[model samples]
Target: MTETWPARFIAAERYRRHRYAANHPLAIPRVSLTLDLIHSYAALSAEEYLVSRRASEDELAWFHTAEYIEAMQAAERAGKVSRASRQRHNIGNLENPYFHDFFTTPATATGGSIQAAEQVLAGYLAFSPAGGMHHALPDQARGFCFFNDPVLAIMRLRREGWRVLYLDIDAHHGDGVELAFRDDEQVLTFSLHMDTAYAYPFIGGGWRDWGVLGNALNVPLPKATRDGEYRWIFGQLWPRVLRAFQPDAVVLQAGTDILLPDPLGKFAISTGFFLELVEEVLHSAPRHPHGVPRLAVLGGGGYHPLTLARCWTGVWGLLSGRRLDEALPEAGRRVLQAVGWDEDEDEDYYPVLFERRVEAAGDGPPREAIRRLAGDLLEQHPLWRGMT
Candidate 1:
């Protein structure tokens, strides 16, 4: 039996102090809420919780351009940006708006992922709930990500001479990370996201876009993709890639936006399916020579606060080997109740959201598009073809 590795949850109180501009998809509380839900369950012990540090300018320079970093800092300082800076760096725009602590907030998140990577390298299973800002480019921001923490974290692992597999399950394509390492043979990037035709960052997720060295695989799921279809695709594809690549470490971007209730996500995935995905990854993750699982999990997009909290809390429970009580404790209930829902939205489903039980969005046979995509990838991709 594989020994259970100690788990660390990386977070910071600063996340609560920062907020995106009003009415933005990310304006809702994510990291802070997940921290509360886990604490409500008493799932984390003092030893397992690590306070996140802010990424210094030197650290951000790992994946970000120095000019872009300075632009972000200037925007935050002025609460605005020059037209040239805005256009050049993609800051102070609708997609990547400026707010208080714009640079520091993402820098802190980057720091969390960096810390998680460090912990994983030290032979522990670590998670940075504030990480997985995968869509930010080296010189620009895209898809609500201002800094690409996932890229930086992967780079940290790469410096140690470890081959890293970056598995992104965000609803949107992990375009930034894929772009960063597509030419590098040491890092393999696999993304399963909503098809670009129907999602944000609307390009570059086609199954055939396998990277320069065939080290990248992009699987775009159709809108409203159910639990069964997701399982079928992941089941058929992930194990094949794992066997062929045999990565020394795996970085999982577990974005909860794929959940059924998320307004921004069209898929009907359930919390149960999400946990199953994490569990499977944990079970099959590769270990270091010292028998420690070299896995670092990061959070991505999840707009629905209630669902995000529940999903991430369950993830921590799984990682820490704690059985969460199905009945929502009063403390957990209060945490859910405290969320400020948009006034324009209906509250009829409010009661259901408080319940800890989320029924699985049942799976069906894979659709023809999904089937064809899987077949094509397995048969055409060099990685799979080269596998014995």
Candidate 2:
């Protein structure tokens, strides 16, 4: 009989206290809300929960520069950023504001990702919902990301000499992570995101921006990409890349921003499709010699707080192999009721967001544009050509 590997969830209560500014897209509670929903449904057992630690300066240095780390710390201590630090580190800017606990928040998230990587290395599947800040650069912040935890997590795995495949399905491109490993042959970075024409960090992530070592693949989908189109492209490309890379481990940036109703993303993806994607990754992840699959899952850009909480809670359920109650328990309903939403969010879906499962809408006809893009990718990409 095959032995079952354990699945662990890494989180920290500090997330509830450390939040971005009010106007920021990330200001809404995400990790905390998800945890509340999980607790309400009794989805996770005590043994499956792992408290996250704060990443040390040396650990942050794995991907971030020492100078940048010091600048962030100083800014955080003062609860503000100096003119010079703002210009140099891009911290005090409107995009990456200097908020309370600016440094500690990302550092803690980075530490959670490090823990997730350690758990994966030890033969357990791990999920870090507080991690996946994939837009921060080595010395600067961008796209509301203060630190690049996904890069740090991948770096942790690389320390063990593991060839890691970084898969990012966030609506926005994972520019920081892709750029960090662009020249490294041991790491393969694949990002399926909204086309730069319509998305933030509106550069690169195009077909022509394949990494220096041909270890990067960026699939830029058009806005309003529906479930069928998304799945069709993923089916054609994901397995092909997985086979070509043959990585020892897989790091998934499971960003719920790709789902429908997200203010930042235009994709029409649903919770059902999102769960299917996660299931595919779990089953297809490369296993170690001891028969344990090496996989680390991290959360990314999800703006709709209620939707994000529901999606991530479902993710934990899938990981823990729990049959979640479809109806929202009274406690779960209370949790959802307490969540604050922006004036821009549609209130019509508020009631259904309390439920554990959100069924996907019927898939529409496949788009010819998606078909053409997939065909070109398979025929012209260096990885695919080499495989052929």
Runs in model 1 deviating more than 4 A are: 1-3, 342-350
Q: Candidate 2 residues 1-388, lDDT tens each?
A: 1335679999999889877778888889899999999999888889999999999999998888888999999988888898998988888988888778878888999999999999998988899999888999999988888789999899999999999999998998889998899778999989999998778888774886787688889899988888888888899998898889999999999999988878888888888889888988887899978867789999999998878888898888877777676687899888877975645345555556665455444387668888888898888888876675
Best by lDDT: 1
How does residue 325 of candidate 2 score in lDDT? 68
For each candidate, what TM-score against the reference? 0.96, 0.96
After TM-score superposition, the amount by which residue 219's alpha carbon in candidate 1 deviates from its true location, in angstroms, is 0.5
Clashing residue pairs, backbone N/CA/C < 3 A, model 1: 228-363
Supply candidate 2's per-residue lDDT for 131.
88
Candidate 2: count of backbone clashes, pairs at least 3 residues apart or interchain = 0
TM-score quality measure for candidate 1:
0.96
lDDT value, residue 48 of candidate 2: 95
